[model samples]
Target: MDHLTALENKSIFIIREAYFRFRNIAMLWSVGKDSTTLLWLVRKAFFGVVPFPVIHIDTTYKFPEMYRFRDEYAKKWGLNLIVGRNEGQVEAGMGPGKGTKLDCCNELKTNALKQIIEKNGFKALLLGIRRDEHGIRAKERVFSPRDENFKWDYENQPAELWDQYKSTAAEDNHFRVHPILHMTELDIWKYMKKENIPLTELYVSKNGKRYRSIGCAPCCSPIDSTASNVDEIIAELESTHTSERAGRAQDKEDAYTMQKLRSLGYM
Candidate 1:
């Protein structure tokens, strides 16, 4: 098989394994390239049908285009999309503008996700986090476990070699399956283009500016770029020196900001 086929096969196998092992599981869709790619993989895994619900934590500050794209695609594809939000915090006038990036992420994104997981009793979450995304993500396993408090134990991650992944975990520990951990950013865009996957328009250049990463609208900024299409984006990633997460404000506030937020159950 070619590289793309091999990646798809591995992801399909992992998704099936997670479905068979976990009683209650769901997939998290951030409406970004990675998660959207994973969403396509899920449909492929189950013969063009996704059995689990796709979760999206709406911070209420996301780019307007994100919601529009999300709703449009979800309906078009017949997706079981579950949107979660912390209405209480939003009503209390809480947002990124009121406090530090860490604090804002905690209230707007992390806490909202935790509540959704608990409310739905999801025993496993399939995330599209890749090892190449960052140093912290590099330490994650194909099937990592998190405690009831959503604390990721990086030191105690399970081992997987030659396609054998460990999917079982204790009662209070939830499994996190990373199907595309080994795929690079280039591989994702290639697969998306090859599969003709629908994506948000925000990634396309708008008046010489385009977002490299999508997050809370107030916190995520666009990088200076001229890439207007998938082909141009692929070329940009090949020559770009900036990190993929550089456009993310929370990541730049401190070296350990991601680790700290993730430790508190942030995705």
Candidate 2:
């Protein structure tokens, strides 16, 4: 009945519900603290075995450490790891450096995710997105649906009053289930502490700098922090006034960048 336990139990219920409601489902593993925590919740829900695939939409621009952490955990946890990429775009010189942040994200990250989901016929995808992470994400539902074109009708999304959720989606598209949507950034770190979750050193400070949010290396900057461990991070978060994604470059591209991206089916 405590705070952390309550969060865990709800997340477990959501994970299991998504699994049973959509048998052809997968979870996104961003190799970040949030998504990694989602992976932990999956194991807890299914009793040590993740019954579905876990996806990493590799833009081919991520930090080398991220890739190493991904591979290590995928094997250590025995995950069916599916690496998603838009090889053609990558080859055609589509990237944050060559184009606008929105364009780059759509081509490399959003389109890549869309292609993989369609190719694999995933009826539902469990994302570790939390509302507290971004302003646009605050508009998300526990069970959000997309059209065949991978477009989200954010304005007309089905309401989820109380615990009721609209899990139904069209035959040609899928649902994006947010199991950890209700959890906050601090909640994630606290859960990590309680669960003894392992994190990549990228989150830990080295030379008074640590990444608060990680994406492709080119777009992710480090914050000034000396919080080298989970306990220190939790303590820092208590007194810090920084946004969780202050290091992400994409959000700074435009005031409505994230909203537009989500509308276009970006995760």
Candidate 3:
């Protein structure tokens, strides 16, 4: 099989395995290129039917385009979409502009996810996280476990070799299943193009700027680029030396901000 085909096959296998192993599970959809591609793969894995709920941890600060794209696609695809939000925090005036980005993320994103997961009693969550995206994510396993507090102990991780994974954990522990951990930024774009996966046009350049990474509107900024099409984006990825998340503001708050964020259950 070709490289892309191999990746696709492995991801499908992982998705199937996660569904079979975890009786109650959900998938996180960030409405970004990677997660949308992942959602597409989930459909293919289950023969055009996703078997579980799709959750979006809404910070309520995302761009209007993102909200529109999410609502439109969620309806069009017939997804069992569940939007999670920390209404109390938002009412209490927690946001990117109010305090440190770390604090805001913890309040809006992490705690919001915690509420939904516990309320729904989800045993596992399929997240679209790639190892190459950031240094902290490189330490993640295909099935990483989190405690009741949603804290990850990165110091101890099980080994997986030759498609064998140790996904066993305490009954109360939550598993974060990463099917696309092996796909890089370039691989994702190529797969999106090959599969005709639809993404929000925010990634496409407008006025010589485009969002390389999509997140909360206040935390994410646009990059200087003119790559409006998928083909042009692939070419840019091949030639550019810039990091994919160079425009993300929360990541720059501290030297280990990403680590801290992920450790506390930030996606």
Candidate 4:
């Protein structure tokens, strides 16, 4: 099999395993290319139907196009969409502009996700995190554990060799299953093009700029790119030395910001 096919098969297997092993599970959908590809993989795993709820952590700061795409695809794809939000913080005018980016993210994203998981009693969460995205994420295992507080213990992690992933966690702890932990940025674009996957228009270039990585409008900036289509995007990614998250402000605020955020359960 080709590389993309191999990645797809591995992801499908991991998704199936998570479904079979966990009693209560959900998939986090950030409405980005990586997560959307993960959703497609879930469909392929379950024979064209996703078997679990698709969760989105809505911070109310996301781009309007993201909200539109989320709702439109939820309807079109027949997804079991569950939207979670830190409504209290949003109502209090707490945002990236009003506070530190780390504080904003912890409140709007991490805390919101914690509340949803606790309320819904989700024992396992299938996230669309790729190891190649960031230095912090590169340390993640295929099946990572989170405490009841939703904190990731980076100091200790389980081993996964020969596709033998350890899914066991304490009764109170939850597992974060990374289905596409192995896919690179280039692989994602290529997969989307090959599969004809639908994506938010924000990814395509507008006036010679495009969002390589989608996030809240307040903290995310568009990169300089003319790659409006998938083919051009793949080519650009092949030659660019820039990080995938160069547009995200929080990551740039501190050298250890991403690590701190992930440890605090910032997904």
Candidate 5:
């Protein structure tokens, strides 16, 4: 099989394995390219029907277009979309401008996710994170486990050789399944194009700028690009030297900012 096909096969197998191993499970959908592509993969894996609920941590500071697209598509596709928000923090004037990037992320994104996982009692969370996205993500395992406190032990993850993954974890601990960890940004675009997946229009370049990676509106910035279509995005990635997360202000605040946030249970 070709590389793309191979990746799809591996991801399908991993999804099925996670389904069998975990009694309570859910997948996180950020409504970005990666997660949208992962949503398509879920349909493919389950024969056009997703078995589990898709979780989205709504910081309430997301781009208006993102929510519009999300609501439209969720209804169009008949998705089991579950939105989680930290009402207390949002009500108390918590936002990117009020706190540091790490603090804002922890309060709005990570803590919200943690509460959702706990409320739903999900034993596994399938994420669409890729290793190439950042340095910290590069150290993730296919079936990585996070403690009740949401600490990721990058140094002591389980082994997964020859397609055999370890899905077991202790009580109250959730396994993070990253099926597309090995895929490059180009592969994701190509797959999305081939599969005819719907995506947020904000990704398409407008006035010589397009968002390479999306997050909270205040923190995420657009990169200089003229690529308006999926094929053009693939071509741009092939020639671009800048990292995908470069436009993300949070990652630029400090060298180890992401690492620190992630260690403290930020996604």
Candidate 6:
């Protein structure tokens, strides 16, 4: 098999494994390229239909296009879309406007995720996170565990040698299954192009800039790029020296910001 096909097959296998292992599992869809690619893999793995619900943590600060693309695709694909949010926090003026980026993310994203997981009684969460995206995410296992409090015990991570993933989690702890953890940013763009996946228009160039990694609108910025389409994005990624999340403000807040966030159960 070719390199891309191999990656696709591996991800598909992981998805199927997670589906059969956890009775109440859901996939987190951020509506970004990586997560969207994961969504495609779900359809492929389940014969053109996604069996589990797709969760979206709405921070209420997302770009307008994100919501549009999300609504459009959920209907187009007939997805079991479940929107998660920290409604109390959002009502109390909790956002990037009132505090540090770290605080905003902790409340808006991490806490929101925790709330949904508990409320929905989800035993496992399928994430599209890749080790290549950020330094902290690199420490993740294929089947990572988080306590009921949503704290990630990175130091005591379970080993997964030779595809033998430890799917079992302790009582009150849920697993964070990362099927695409081995895939890179370039791999995602290339696969999207190869599969002709419908992506958010925000990734394409507007004027002389384009979003390399998308998040909440206030904290995310576009990089200087002329890549207007999937093929151009793949070409640009080949020679680009920039970090994928270079435009993300939360990661720049402090050196251990992401580590701390993930430890506190941040996605």
What overall lDDT goes with each candidate model? 0.87, 0.91, 0.92, 0.91, 0.89, 0.91
Please, what is the TM-score per model? 0.91, 0.92, 0.93, 0.93, 0.92, 0.92
> What is the alpha-carbon lDDT for the whole of candidate 2?
0.91
Candidate 1 pairs with clashing backbones: none
What shift in Å separates residue 157 of candidate 3 from its native position after superposition?
A: 0.8
Score candidate 3 by TM-score against the native: 0.93
The RMSD of every model to the true structure, in order and in angstroms, is 5.7, 5.8, 5.7, 5.7, 5.4, 5.8
Structure candidate 5, residue pairs in collision = none
**lDDT assessment of candidate 3:** 0.92
Better of 3 and 4 by lDDT: 3
What lDDT tens digits, residue by residue, belong to model 1 across residues 77-172? 789999989888888878877877678788878888888988888988999988888989988888888998789988887777786778767877
lDDT of 2 by residue, 1-267 (tens): 999999999999999888888899999999999999999999999999999999999999999999999999899999999999999999999988887877998999889998988788999999999999878899999999988777889999998997888887667869999999999999999999999999999999999999999988988999999999999999999999978887774465655886788899996
Clashes of each: 0, 0, 0, 0, 0, 0
Residues 150-208 of candidate 4 have per-residue lDDT tens digits of 88999899888898888887899999999999999999999999999999999999999
Runs in model 3 deviating more than 4 A are 249-267
Kindly provide the TM-score of model 5 when superposed on the true structure, using C-alpha atoms.
0.92
- TM-score (C-alpha, index-matched) for candidate 6: 0.92
Model 4's TM-score against the true structure: 0.93
Best by lDDT: 3
Candidate 5 global Cα RMSD: 5.4
Candidate 6 regions exceeding 4 Å error are: 249-267
